[model samples]
Target: MSYELRDHTADVAVEATGDTLAALFAAVADGLTAASAESVPATGGDRFDVEVTAESREALLFDYLDRLIYERDVRLVLPADHRCAVVEPNEAAREGDSADPDAWRLAAGARGVPLDAVAAREIKAVTYSEMALERRGDGWYAYVVFDV
Candidate 1:
């Protein structure tokens, strides 16, 4: 997984690419955490599971990141390491004509330290502007904008 932070007028942006949807999500999550913390260690305090679902890929990403920010603000902690898995409909779903937007979901676990120790900028919220989630060749790529 790889990600880069881009400059935006009053917000911050993150563009990430991965071999799979889950990897891409993980990268973005890492980027979000990095934006709020200088260094996220591989091992830390406690662990928590986060689960989210949305209508589309882009919505799913927005919800996922927003969930992270919510957790940080409420629980006052940051993840040092995380693992995620995204379940999405395949070409097989087209054969069934299922339009259930709730079918797409992501499950993840974050491990880390309390928010008091980390030093970095705070992300206000996730934004839809300049957001993209698409398949590029054999991998997946995404661009997310944050209201910093």
Candidate 2:
């Protein structure tokens, strides 16, 4: 997993690339966390699970990041580590499956922290107005604009 930070016209931009979509998402999360804290130790003892569906890969990526931002703002949960599984649907509807319209499933967990301890510039929210996620060669890449 790997990611890089670049300057954006409006918000901070993050680009992540990985062998798999799940790995790419995990790297994105780690990058976001690093923007605020000096370092995120792999010692989160808490767990969180979330399922979100969108109309496109870009939307799905935005939703995934938004969920993490929600946890930061509402629950004060900052994830230092993440695990994701992309659920592929078959011709027949799968049980416990909702119409995602998109092509991914992003369920993950992270360690929790106090809201007061979170940095103010880490990320305010995940903006959908200008977000993108695309396939590149054998891996996946994503661009997220955070409200800083």
Candidate 3:
């Protein structure tokens, strides 16, 4: 899995690729962290868990990133070292028989340090504008833009 930050017109965009859906999400999460900070320490920080769910995979990604931004703001930390897993929808859910709004779920574990520990940039929000997620040749690729 890997991720890279690209220059957008005025905002910031991230492109990520992974061998699996879970890895794809994790790489994107890592990209978000990198976009939020110029440098983060390798060790000694607080750890946290985030769980987010949505009706669709794209929505799940949006909410997941938004939640991380929320966490950063609320906890005053710069997140890093992300580990993420995606739970696919069950057959019933996919068939629209399940009423759960959280049919698509993402569980993530991450580490973060106080914002003072790094040179931080303020990311206003994650946007659907120009967002793209797709499967390509046995791997997954994602593109996300952030309003800085």
Q: What is candidate 3's local distance difference test score?
A: 0.88
Q: What is the lDDT of residue 135 in candidate 3?
A: 95
Runs in model 2 deviating more than 4 A are 89-104, 115-122
By lDDT, the better pick of 1 and 3 is 3
Compared with the true structure, what per-residue lDDT tens digits does model 2 show for residues 1-91? 7988767776777878989888888888777777656655455346777776655556667788788888777776675677776554441
Measured with C-alpha atoms, the lDDT of residue 111 in candidate 1 is 79
Which residue pairs does candidate 3 place in steric collision?
none
Which whole-number lDDT from 0 to 100 does residue 122 have in model 2? Answer: 63
Sort by lDDT, best first: 3, 1, 2
Best by lDDT: 3
lDDT of each: 0.83, 0.69, 0.88
Q: Which pairs of residues collide in model 2?
A: none
What does candidate 1 score on TM? 0.88
lDDT-superior candidate, 1 or 2: 1
lDDT string for model 1 (1-148, tens) is 8888888889888999999999999999888887777686555679999988777888889999999888888888886476889877563265462666346778998875787666757899999998999999999999999998
Give the least accurate 10-residue stretch of model 3, judged by summed lDDT: 92-101
